[model samples]
Target: MKEVPASGAFRQLEPGPIVLVTTSYRGKPNIMTMGFHMMIQHAPPLIGCVIGPWDHSYSALRATGECVIAIPTIDLAETVVDIGNCSGDTVDKFERFGLTQQPAGSVAAPLIKECLANIECRVVDVVEHHSLFILEAERLWIDNDHREWRTLHHRGDGVFAADGNVLDLCDRMVKWRHFPR
Candidate 1:
């Protein structure tokens, strides 16, 4: 491990899978690709994610305090990257990508029909200094019929990794069994 720039530390510590966050404001719905997000709590199903002022979805989230986190599978790798490459301010991502939009139960933000799972969330807190939004899951929708289950992970730059073979260690999770599934 040779000396590398400290700025590149995030590449090694990237958290969780890349997801699409949707927000609707003034009857216009928008989707943004998010790679910086993590689970913060379990009881209330809280999630912390970075959606800075630079992002088009930021204003909508700030005003509405709601959004949907859609987890896409490996098959959408190219589409996911393409979504992030453009700005929602100029483009209607849902129509541009031909992605089906399904109405969410708890939030005005629509869910991507192609994704593996969609979590409707409401902002519970905002850490303005860090551009962090703490969201509480209001509802969850999963596609049990969708065959693709592998999710994508961003490794900084243009690199990404997809979920691979499962290492079933359920028997070894004695201490974590009490945690919710």
Candidate 2:
């Protein structure tokens, strides 16, 4: 086995798909690309994500305690990376990317019409030390008609993998039969 730096661990075990997080404070809305996030609970639908002060949207998220997590498909890969490359502090990402903003019902943050799914969330708790925000899903919106369903997975260092093929093993799961497929 080859020894690897601990700092490179994230590239080996990157969680879920790359997502776009939107926050609105005062009257201005902003969006940032997030690669560090995961589902923490199912009953209340809690999600844990890392949004530090370095991110321009962090202040808005902390002040308002609300944000929208938008899941973009493979087709929007370039736009997603471009959104992350620039700061919302200097650029109006929505306008710069020509992304359509749809009003969210539970949060002031706008949903990206181009994304595959959008989850409106409210911050339930914050771990200041780690800049971890625990969010509860308040609402969810999905584009049932969208043809592209593949999502992007960040592999660190600007590399990414797109979802491909299907592995249906639902029947093999004896313990998870009670849950929806």
> Best-fitting candidate, measured by lDDT?
1
Residue-level lDDT of model 2, residues 1-181, one tens digit each, is 9998898887877847999999998989999999999889987899999997998899999899999999999999899999999998899999999999999997899999999999999999999999999999989999999899999999986689999898998778998776654
| lDDT of all predictions | 0.93, 0.92
Clashes by residue pair, model 1: none
TM-score of each: 0.95, 0.96
Measured over all alpha carbons after superposition, the RMSD of each candidate to the real structure, in angstroms, is 1.2, 1.1
* Candidate 2: Cα lDDT at 47: 98
Candidate 1 local lDDT, residue 104? 95
Clashes of each: 0, 0
Identify the runs in model 1 with alpha carbons over 4 angstroms from their true place: 1-3
